[model samples]
Target: MKLLLLKTLLQRRARDEGFTLPMVIALGFVMILLGMTNIVKSSEENLNAITQNSSSDALAVAEVGITKYRELLNQNRILTIYNDDQWNTNANVTGQACNDLTTTPTGWEDGGTATAPNDTTKWWELREDTDGDGTDELIGEYRLVSYQYDIDDDDFDSSTPPTNNNGQFSPSDDNANTTDDFTFNDVTYDPLGVIGTSNSPEGYNPTGILTVQGRSTDGSEAQIKVEIPLRINQNDLENLDPALWIGSTDTTYLANLNGNLGSLTVTDGNVVIIDAASAGSSGCSDPADGASYTVISDAREVPSISSIASKRTEAVNAGINNSIPVTSPAVLGKTDDDPYVTPPSGATFDEDIHCANISDCRYYYDLSATDITAVTETDGIAKVTLYVDGNLNINQDLGSNVSSSYLEIYVTNSGSITIDSDSTNTINALIHAPESQLTVNGTGTVKINGSVWVDKFVNNATVEIEPDTTRISSLNTAPSYKLYSTATARTPRPLTGSPTNWVREEVQ
Candidate 1:
């Protein structure tokens, strides 16, 4: 009986052993599968991290390109060979190359050819020290391509290919269509809305679209495009603040014992007097009326004579010396009879004069003689910046009308100015003579519709000297022609506002 029981037990134990062996093998296979799945997940995570890093690097390189372009504009180096009129030719790139920056622009190519001159090499390579060692590692590269953003169509893909082989990307680009192409087509834009009237779009040049293609070492690429518009610098005329500025600190009576005869109405500015502030300090009938100006003792110090003279010197250097010998009844600027007057000597008064209109405008005038009977801009509107070495005498009105003409008389050398116009007539001018005196001597009411900056002002006649808002606004219209070069005139608009004026976008 014992032998039979032992045999049965041995068979059962063998069966149990077979089942356990199969279970062990199955557990080993399941463990191997889980290890393989973990390995695959780790590989995918590493690949995703690498892709994300490349994308980030490409975007950083593209932003660097935009920064480089902005730096060029800030340096005022954009219009060295171009103007606002031919803004299309001033594009950073031409044709489809603007969108497809892999094919470089005309002026910026690899090993630049005759048709493409790479003055500033092609790629901006990015280098980094990945391992924190002394040597820098090459990370990525980027290139810049720009297009002219015309406000008329409001699109970015309208650039045409360059036509000429000059490789300068200039007037010969679009069949030599070098006319004033910056004017908008039926678009209404009110800048600042100060005048209430829709101003002419002469100074508001068209915008530019700058695209940057950034590539990482791992073949990852990205594109970024931004709008670069032209903007007027706010502090372009920082010196000309007060409407009527007196530089004299000497005790001079503004009123000649007659309680100050005429009126001096100021608008949109102050009447700063460096002299002692007393009752009737401004010498006006109503100093606090429609004119809200102050008469502080130390409001502002007078500008030096040399500083004012340097401005005249700068204008002379800029080929603005449209000079003539002052004679009685001699017209200085353009007239209806001779609208396009090319002077016999000195600089030529052509369409490039610094003014609102682009016709034959004469901005700088170096009058040889001192006396003058009449000065007028008979042809349309003109702005004159007259430099008088000797004493100036105005026997008649300086400008024709307030709206049509403007004048800035500079008498840097110690000289005086005598305004002897009729009471009914008006003298519209900005007189700046820090080392001289101004005498308004007329029996009738002579109105001066501009500002005055002199050492001393002697009002012997009935005169009203104040600056109107219209004239003040004209000083800011075209700042390239301003008397003070306080700041650069035109610059790329700041990255503000909506996508229309200035914006940034990522390209697919």
Candidate 2:
């Protein structure tokens, strides 16, 4: 009975107990732990990849930006040098070398041994064994160095090759020795280099070379150097041709009057001499109006008798003694009588009419020997007559070709008349003022049928005459009245207390 009870209790205990629950709990814990480990490993791998790519990309972009900035700086320097007026090709300022970074390794230091690391600060000590020797001998060294930023730490690091086995680079050292170790302050950090040698207060590091390295955002490395030459300004080309600069031609003309004509004289019977001497006066005047004349200097004296006599004797001996008859029958009329009363019925003469004023007189009639005749003087008319008995002589001293039919006449008549031409050729005539004096002043042609007389010549006046193929003469003489008259006789005064009249009044 005791044995049976024990067996039953044991059976009950065995049936109530469970071992699968604990086992299932332990298996769940293990799976959770394995999953957590896989998640941590994947996260770390992804973060590492992202960090490396981000660092490389940032570095590339920064390098590209720096390169562009440097290029712009170089271009600006070149322009500044070119615009300087004092720039000269032979001028000695300062010079440095421009190197291609792609071909040369900048900021390089030589390692003491092949297995040992190099000191970047000792760039000058670096030497290439061009002859394949086991050891390199120091020769010439590159002056420029380069560096890149460590994107992971935001620190600047030299991209140039190591200079020596010291595995260091410093910009503070003046010589490339083992004592020189690269430091942040030793490298030339300026990206622009615009400050030039004054980049440091104690002066730029000689042995402590700077390293400038650039990379494009697309992963391209570029290294270049530029040369800037000074040039002269546009205005500084002293020997340049004026035509090329101004793009035009230059010209000039005569300025003012130089001098005056000399003296004149006349001596003969009924002969008129015209003075061709230059007159220094300023304005024109009338010949018939006794009050209108040019002012003459009291210092102006007539020619001496000896001079006149010599000229007259020379002229007479030249077979020029042909004279007009003084006793020829005069026109049967008074000074105011009409001389054209017997004009032919079907004749015509060139005529011009001007305003009725003494200041403006019209000239008419053909300038030919056949049209040479006298007419009457009326209120607005003045007549001119030339009487030829046998022959007339026309002398032109200026030595110019004379037209046989040329004639000049001045008449005050407002109406036309018939001009009787003895020749069939056309007559060339020039007629001017009836009251103003006409002076033959230039070298020209002239013809005459009889004698001519000219009393005086005003300043700046010219006269040309052509007469018939006959004897003509001329005589020059002084005026009979004063040339310049005072205004005292012609000016009138205002009555007392009346406003004074500033205008001058004409005398009756």
lDDT of each: 0.47, 0.24
| Most accurate candidate by TM-score | 1
For model 1, residues 111-139, the per-residue Cα lDDT tens digits are: 33322212223566667689998887777
lDDT of 2 by residue, 33-122 (tens): 999999999999999887666545434433332333233223222212111111122121011011101111222343442211112222
How many residue pairs clash in all the candidates, one count each?
A: 1, 44
RMSD of each candidate? 18.4, 41.3
Model 1 pairs whose backbones collide = 423-445
Cα deviation of 465 in candidate 1 (Å)?
26
**Which ten residues in a row are the worst by lDDT in model 1?**
169-178
What's each prediction's TM-score? Answer: 0.38, 0.17
